[model samples]
Target chain A: MTLSSGTVAPGAPTRTATGSVTVRALRLLESFTAERPELSLSELARRSGTPLSTVHRLVGDLMEWGALERDPSTGRIRVGLRLWEVASLAPRALSLREAAIPVLEDVAAVTHENVQLGVREGDEVVFVERIRGRRSVRLLTRVGGRFALPPTGIGLALLAHAPADVQERVCAGPLRRFTPYTVTDPVRLRAMLAEVRRSGVAVSDRQVTDDAVSVAAPVFDRSRAIRAAVSVVVEADTGRPAQLTPLVRAAALSIGRALG
Target chain B: MTLSSGTVAPGAPTRTATGSVTVRALRLLESFTAERPELSLSELARRSGTPLSTVHRLVGDLMEWGALERDPSTGRIRVGLRLWEVASLAPRALSLREAAIPVLEDVAAVTHENVQLGVREGDEVVFVERIRGRRSVRLLTRVGGRFALPPTGIGLALLAHAPADVQERVCAGPLRRFTPYTVTDPVRLRAMLAEVRRSGVAVSDRQVTDDAVSVAAPVFDRSRAIRAAVSVVVEADTGRPAQLTPLVRAAALSIGRALG
Candidate 1:
């Protein structure tokens, strides 16, 4: 699930002249993923593209500051608690997650669907939080994971509110096809985005997967800027996208009010 | 709640050479605390001790990178979700919290007491997560908050497993007193820790507050190193500490199994 070493995370600044090894160190941390949470020192060095000694020194600094810690027996490194405590204060994610959870719980309780919250990050939509219902359909998204902005219902809702260039660039995407129903053609995708803007809700039926259909709506901040999207995924067959729109939109509005 | 201006975060490194104006900029970010989650540029500069112009420039960098964001209505600085995303990968707190929550909940359900999960951080105990029982006595602790690692039952549980030197250092401390029942004498505290180690559980009878007593036990990793402590806080006079030990220890064991 993790990108290979030497693959710098997106938004990583061009590392040319600034005596900013710090940002690069942060980008190095971006290499650790949920699938590969623990990494050996050599693996970290290799993955971060830093010299072993440099990695060792930086790791030492991080450990000292409680940003990183090694498993005493395995000698593998894991993310430390201090980082999490600081992160818990991230207003955009934490506040949104806190507001969205109860509504997502309500959504899941009613539809027994997969409930999700996503926000725009550059050309992608990052799933900030997710809650699965007991008998929900399968989903590929994970909390804190990112996906291209034109594929899913939540993605379309976010894309509909993005700047013209962002939307244009997404429309120009070499869109990855997950199923036969995915709208790979830029023209059709643009129309879908426009319809999302028109109806104030987005329907992504079996676009992400063959057996799932998601209904999503935009969540706005005080300026009515689309800050987030809320969605519920139910079984593809007998899926009532229109019927679920009001429920999804209501959840989005509640979250928007909470955010405001 | 926040210290000096643009203090560097865990991953940030500042240089004395560039007189790295960025260091002061980072301090502006630190100016926002859990209590005061937002700040204006003046507040940022004043708190961080940076020049107003430098604060402006550094704030721009952080705002650009989404490490800090402005409230749409108030234009106040708040911690950004991007920083939260980067820091959420920290596995230490969340992993322990996830493993411990169900067991903590179970303990709280059975005892109607506040159940908490905490790990040792420096000479303090930082609460990773907590489940407040309906009938539990109020505690001074909050999730993601820190306290001295001596008086609380969870603290003793973790401290009991700490190295001899670490325990000695804690005993050497100017221990803060919460109530008359709090053990202030080092000799008595040392004896308490010894008994905790021997019994594999720790009990604090009204150590933190006049009304609350707590029972706690250690959560071990597969390597048998104490990773976290789980505890239940109840009314001091309602239950015997010895009787609560088995229940707290059982919860800790449940968490240990979950971690494994």
Candidate 2:
């Protein structure tokens, strides 16, 4: 998902001509999104709102440190492998994905469905891992992409276990609807979340897309606190969410145990 | 692997007390490793060689930009999910991994061996993806980790196709020996690389570990230039590198075609 440039911390220093160099460099990085994975120097300067000369110097530093790379043939800039190496140490994403992959693989192997893992990031659900089954329906999600808390099963599971304020904030929202089956009513969404919390499983039927359904369950850490969520998504026409509920729950439990 | 702080550009500014703020911030990120994924602010300062006051301010800015995260329970800092999300767009790592995964999975499924993908970064080979089969031999390699260019099969494949300068530099010596079978002699390593180039595959028999053997082949891009390498590692005792060579080569070819 595209990072919002306005997501600055409250009370943080304002972005101005003399703003923090670190922030400006990071904004340059944020400018490279899924849609525009590569950009020229001028594009980077424009997108990051930095002076051309400053962007040039910052880009050089970033390239040297391996935070960004220059394409040899095209001379465009993209995220560097070294940055990915450091970011791989992020416990919230790759570490969690490592812990859940074996179990996710098992679910995908048995059900031949799209298996996913996600964690709450603010009011959004950041998908950390996804295994596309050989026979699974196409999903709109991708690894490292974010979705609203009430849209997909994995998001629902995480939202159900989230703090009250987060739940309320989502419940009282101008929720984006993807399909006719998507639950947009605050009352209905609350009931769905409550059911997820009570049953330890969330069934999202065609909520994200008209052709897909997902069954999800929350994963816990050693402290018995919900840390992430796992789900198995399948084609809506012939999907059996009820039958897959126990499998998804079992995978979630196994992932939680692995995390411990 | 621990990133060497000395890997700065040839003419980059010296990291003095009044050096670039962006460099200091990046060094702070470099302080976190696979082994020490979490660190206190003071530890970060110590590891990054930045003043505590500067580190504190940098850490604040980093945390605000979602480049770093503070664990709520431990109050320790680590790489943030936002950084990982941005890094996931790195074409050399995750994007290549995405293109190679289907073929890698096929190799893993058919051989029930350890599948790995790696790309050259300077003189080192950085592993971007790895899939351990259920019945595969244990491996020392991890995703996002770096290895020397002469020992592992994937490394050899990349090294064989590397630029002349890179190949010669690696062949110059001081190779770390991981096992009795690891090729330490520059002459022998050069011969191995030659064979890899001629045969379109590299075999590492008990190189990194005494009990495992790996067969690797180089993956090419649309321009027919070697971009990465793919390998399947198996138990040394029962492994048939000769039998697996063609399979690894085919997987590599499939991955390269996918990259097109």
lDDT of 2 at A42: 91
Candidate RMSDs in order: 6.7, 4.3
lDDT of 2 by residue, A1-260 (tens): 21224433434443355556677778789888888899988998888788887677777668767899877778788899989999999988766888899998988899888899999999998899988899979888889888888989988999999889989999999888999999999999999998998999998999898999989999998897888999999888898778998888999999999987
Candidates in order, TM-scores: namely 0.79, 0.93
What are the Cα lDDT values of the candidates? 0.76, 0.86
- Give the number of the best model, judged by DockQ: 2
Model 2 local distance difference test score: 0.86
Model 1 TM? 0.79
Q: What pairs collide in candidate 2? A: none
> How high is the lDDT of residue A219 in model 2?
97
Quote the positional error of residue A84 for candidate 1 in Å.
Answer: 2.3
lDDT of each residue in B57-166, candidate 2, tens digit only: 77876886799988777878889999999999898876788899999889889988889999999988899998889888988878998888789999999999998998
Clashing pairs in 1: B5-B27, B5-B48, B6-B26, B6-B27, B6-B28, B7-B27
Q: Each model: TM-score of chain B?
A: 0.87, 0.92
**Top candidate (TM-score):** 2
lDDT tens digits, residue span A224-260, model 1: 8878999998888876767898899999999888875
- For residue B39, model 2's alpha carbon misses the true position, in angstroms, by 0.9
